[model samples]
Target: MASVSSSRSSPIGKLPVDVFDSILSILNEEDRDTLKNCSSVTKQWHDRCVRIIFSSLDINNKNTNAFPAFQTWLSINVDAAAVVKTLRIWKLPVEIDVDQLASVLAPLAGLQNLTLQFIREPQSQIKSSSPLSIQGPRSRSLNTLELLLPSEANRSMLAALTVICLFDTINTVGMQGFSSLKPDLRSTEGLTKVHQLRLQYLPQACASEEMNMFSGIMTSAHLRSLYLECHSPSSWDGLRILSQTFVNLKFVDLDLVQLKNCVKDVDWTTLWKALSSCAQLQRLRINPPSLVDALVTAPSKLFQTSLTSGGCWEVLRELVIGPGYSPRAESLPNRIQRMLWDLPGIVRHDLRGPFPNLDTVTVEVPLSAPMQKRDENGRSNGLAAPTVVSSEQVKSAIVRALPSLQEEGLLRITVIGRT
Candidate 1:
């Protein structure tokens, strides 16, 4: 028994510090909790494991009072706070006293990532002040900043941080109350370094003013990706601003359900005129289904003519068009097929089913046609009417369309049918 016990403990004790660190890195919160409870087994393990496990701190209103206590603890154990890499504070309903927040933020100057999701009421009006007044210690090591302000007005704290150049990469900056922000994002210095921007629930009250400010940021040429989610119809102005200003955009994800309103006012000629300038665009996704519905509902002749007159679908490599709530009359698959047929550069077509690339054709055939599947002598079963296209006809169409596809060295074909 003594010999077996000695062998069991030897391997764990012999593990290198780097191997232990790697194992600890992959642990989730529960696993880390277990490790922390067991840290007293050895002095070397206790020192290294405790530091790695407690290197991230999350604070919110529920434990707001604890922050001061944490500061007191950190004063005695400065190395503990200095090692923290990620700091997240969110949804503090009450206005945080700036002095209190500054004290907590001061010790977190070594943080590599910081996220703040602050809630402020829309009706509440606060006097404007220069963000410079709230500047804290600069974090030269910080690289990512995520701000989620639910109120329309800017958070003076975040604006101040941006002006002070606290972050280097500025990975994601999301604004929830965009309509409420004063249209002077330029006031926050170093915004041009932000690579990803997301605007959620645009304020309906002040559309144009907010959009103009948004346009100024996108025109900076350094922005690489944008995500816009409009909750109200009036927020469509931001889409118009993007369509007009962000000509050099390479990737865009637009969730503007209210885009139909913008489409109503859009001059196809002028809209495509601006879109054509996105010469390097590689990926584009439009959501909420309304945009496609609007396109299909437009008089067919007008839609076709607009496509022929230089639309923006010429260079797309990947396109996703559904999983949205739209009317059945807007046949997305048929519309996509038409668009691909019209665009000469679209060599690959991926749609609803087995049709992988347009080079090959795939078809699904039912074991029995609706008419043939009727209960006696092929008469109506008095149930919902079945589709008219037969499986054999669909297979025939594939054979028909194959010659043209094969001419491009695409003879591969797949067929699937349901009984």
Candidate 2:
């Protein structure tokens, strides 16, 4: 039993080099302690295990003293910092100085991804340098950056955004919870080619201001994808600005959350009117209530009149509607069919052309109670069920309305709901 126990704990160095590499490659940062134990077994194992352990670093307070401990470890073994490719610093302590954070990040020359979230009370005048410590004229290799803040936008947070944007390698950025956009964000030269931008958690009062800020920062030709998660009707003003500002935009996703003060019936005319300018738009996802409201309130001749005026969405290809609320009207299918058939011509007039590049439509509806099947003896064997419209029925209705879609097989309809 003693011999068996000793053999079971034999040195990791006994394994073949290929086998050792494979074992280390499969283990993530979660297995850091086990990897450290393996590294202590022998010199060869040390190189393999340490590289895997230090490849990505997450610094946060949730683990209790993890950031300080990592700083201490990094100070002792400075070479390990070069192995880091992804760094995440979230929920930092207010007591930690910006200089201290800078010094810790300076060693990561190979870092490619960085996410920073500072939630503590804001401090003024922290003179932060470029987070990446790359030297010489060579551009940074970092590709993605994510900045998350609370609903309030302070001078300190804007300064952080400025410091981060100094890096030329970032091609995509996702920012959330910023209540306003400062003009300083527009001076970022590195954002010229930032093709993808995500703006989330926009509040009602700040919607117009944020749109103005974004319009200033993003040049029309540079931005391609824009996503907005808004909490007010003021989103219409922002969307209008975005449509006119980013003419080359290919994708747009809009999520309008119902705010406490907003009306139950939203008017989508402003949003649709804004969309009229996006001639290059290929993909769009909008809240279902907007479309439902437009059809319910607007006259059918309004669409025909708009078609004659030459306002159409000719380049649109993909559309997605929401997990919707129940509409006020019962003839939803007919209204939807009428809008789908005539929407292309409503925004633009292109009689010689196909009018739309549309290929796919996705609708997410609420599930309804299903009817139960009964058995013999007619003693109420759970056969009664509520009458409900199925997704298939909706699909069939759409196909019937547009028979050309059925013949061409170019249109793909996805209806998601109860079974």
Model 1: lDDT equals: 0.48
Residue 307 CA displacement from its true place in model 2, Å? 3.6
TM-score of each: 0.59, 0.67
lDDT of 2 by residue, 92-169 (tens): 532335455555666788887888776655553434432222233434556777877765645434544443444554
Which candidate has the top score in TM-score? Answer: 2
Any idea what lDDT model 2 has? 0.56
TM-score of model number 2: 0.67
Candidate 2 residue 19 C-alpha distance from true site, Å: 26
Looking at model 2, residue 162 earns an lDDT score of: 49
lDDT measured at residue 235 in model 1 versus the true structure, 0 to 100: 49
- Which parts of model 1 have CA positions greater than 4 angstroms off? 1-39, 62-67, 77-79, 93-103, 109-112, 121-128, 132-144, 151-166, 183-192, 215-219, 231-236, 242-248, 257-274, 277-279, 288-323, 326-419
lDDT tens readout by residue for model 1, 36-144: 4553456655555546644666655453455665566556546556767887776543244555555676776566777766676445333324333445444354456
Clashes of 1: 3
